[model samples]
Target: MNRVDTAVHVEGLRKRYGDTIAVDGIGFDIDPGQVFCLLGPNGAGKTTTIECLEGYRRPDAGSIRVLGLDPLADHGELRRRIGVQLQEASLPARLKVWEILKLFSVLYEREKVPWSLLDHLGLEEKRDAYFDKLSGGQKQRLFVALALINEPEVVFLDEITTGLDPRARHAIWDLIRGIKEGGATVVLSTHFMEEAEALADRVAILRAGKIVANDTPEALMRSIQRDDEVRVHVEGSLDAAAIEAIEGVATASIDGDQLIARGVGRGWIARLVNGIEAQDASLLDLSTRRASLEDVYLALTGEDEYSPESPATEEAGT
Candidate 1:
């Protein structure tokens, strides 16, 4: 990949542990100020790939460039220009949050105001609290603040919202959007399909040490051949056989007063409604479901072990 005009560039990247290959010759480039996501299931080599870019682990083969500098060769300069939040990290149990932030700030040539970062991540109240005393969500937010303390040109977040509640998850999503708006490139690694769909400008899906697919979420979803579904709750019973006989519907089933139909595309929605009306059924409520990132991931990787609600885990390398 061309290194010019890119925030991160990798080519023929490969890593291994004894006989087990963690990364197998993968390559992808991230543009400046774009939210690029590395998405895959646990043990899919997400952590290994990101760490190679962060200079934490050396790849057996391939080349990497972040901000126009080699991660391993120019470690000092690259460290100052890029921020990282690992999948797993730790701080001294006795260290107060403010102290942690202050300590990390001085390690870089340029740093953002520690307290301001705390406020931005909603960790100001925990600033005086010890690292061991903060809640899981609070601690995660503090780690995010630490990653941003350097005002990095590129930020790497690996499973940053792994165990947080819905509110906390959305807060971090907003922060990611803010990071992009501030002209910083973000490389986020996660298995959550909704999260990637919500935040990623482009997504690269990995599986078994290789990239299976890469594209915008919309484009990727469009690439797959899947049926759209429409569910309608009716006051009167709708015959499954009659609905299935509709010109555009592929299949239809009825449960209680609800009619569920899988069809070709959005255009079938209107046809189904008209068909239902002709059958003398009152449509009380209706909703349509379209192809999503999860669909694309499953179709490309053929992995169903990962779910949206499952806890996130990194590969063996950490």
Candidate 2:
């Protein structure tokens, strides 16, 4: 892709600390108005890569361009055009949310209305709350609002939803969608499989400081041939043979009060429902799970869901 047309461009990117290579000669281009995500486990170099792109850390090697400007050489110009919400952000403890937003807006040449942003982020009620008094999710929203105070062309969000409740996380996801809808290119780093799947237009999965896979969530899942599963709770007996007889079903079994079917192809849920309806059993609850970004992450990185249980820290080289 042409670098000039891209919102963010990186080529042969490398960063090292002592003997450890935090980012290993990686390269990718992000298009304008796209939601690009860096996904991996803790210490997989997601934070390091983001820091380099944000001009906070100078890369040991390679070139990076945000909004067609070098992040390091044109730090001042780039800062104005790009917004960042770091993995860990800080502000004066006594500062109120409105005060923080106003403070950041003064630094930008083109300022967005602070109250509008607070309203959009659902922080209108917390407008006067002190930074130290806000809950984790509220603080996250405030950080995001500050990131947008500049009306930036590109935004970088690193692990923005970590440790938040499900409702808050989903709300953050909606905010991300709104950011993209507003025409800002978003580069976010996350280890949460669902977050990447839900928000990323394209995902670059890093493992051991290098990109192992990069593609849209659907394409990545399609690249690997994983099976879909169907489960149904029935009021009466379920014939395992009847379910297994359905086309594409690899296996079927009755587990306690539920009928479970595993399949290699699509439309298994509809087929299973039809098959079950034909039987004497009454279907009570039914659900189907397809191959997800989590499956793709596990398959590509060779790491299980619980492998990297530790929280990411700067000292850990995340």
Candidate 3:
């Protein structure tokens, strides 16, 4: 593929801290004008890989290109073309909103006018508010504004919506959507399943320092057929033993009056019908739902749910 057609391209990227390997030979490509998400649990190296692409950390081995330029060897030129909102961002507590924006604007050769971000981010009322005085949501917006001051061709965000309430998180998602619409490639690392499902044009799921899964959310789910589930409703109790013995049944459970079974494929529906009939239970209703992204995550990593178990989830603290 023509490298210029891709926004970010990584191959055999590796990073380590002494004895600990953070990222291990990961590779992927991101298209321009798309929102790409890096997803994983704690210590999965999502942040490490993103930092390497942002030129914040050099890789121990392998290559990465952002906007068709080497992020490390071409630091100065790359910085001018890329934006970054780190997971843990802080500003001088005493500095007002506009003051910091002005500070960042002067650092770049070309940048959006300082006040324009205040208007664009709907922070005109807090233009003079001190950094410490702003609410969690407002501070996040300021960080985004700073990242955009340079009007970069690509942006990197680490845990963008961490610590935000539902309303605030939705607002940030909208802002990210708008950024993509405005023609900036956004690469974000997040643990939120909904965030990945909602925003990412494609997602890469990392685990144990390696790239385990990378694809569109729907494609990823469909790729893992065993995660699909079927729900059956019956007036009486289910024949738990017979259902459990059925072929393709990965797991079977009872929820209220429903007998839920997850199987290897849609063919499980046939196995389920046979099992139910042999038990003489009236199958009132049978329904099927495709595997979700969360299900795929659990299946690939064999870990807890993607969102709730991550340390980032605790950091969100909401």
TM-scores of all predicted structures: 0.90, 0.87, 0.80
1 against 3, candidate with superior TM-score? 1
Candidate 2 residues 1-318, lDDT tens each?
A: 123579989999999999999999999999999999999988889999999999999999999988888898999988887888833345888998888888777767444546788889998898898888998788888888888887889999988887777798899999999999999899998888888989999999999899999999999999988777778899888889988998888999998889888998667677788888888888999888878888889898886543542443322223
- Put the candidates in TM-score order, highest first: 1, 2, 3
lDDT tens readout by residue for model 1, 1-318: 233598999999999999999999999999899999998887889888989999998999999999888999999878888888833345888999888888887776444545788888888788799888987678778877888888889999988877777788899999999999999999998878988999999999999899999899899999999899888999876778888888889999899988889999556889899989988888999998889999888888776666657753433224
User: For model 3, what is the error of residue 168's alpha carbon versus the real structure, in angstroms, after optimal superposition?
Assistant: 1.1
lDDT minimum window of 10 residues, candidate 3: 309-318
Better of 1 and 2 by TM-score: 1
- lDDT for model 1, on a 0 to 1 scale? 0.85
Candidate 1 is scored at a TM of 0.90
Query: For candidate 2, what is the TM-score?
Result: 0.87
Please list the Cα RMSD from the true structure of every candidate, rounded to 1 decimal place. Answer: 2.9, 3.3, 4.6
What candidate 1 gets wrong by more than 4 Å, as runs, is 1-4, 86-90, 236-246, 254-256, 312-317
Q: Which lDDT values do the candidates have, in the order given?
A: 0.85, 0.85, 0.84
Query: Best-fitting candidate, measured by TM-score?
Result: 1
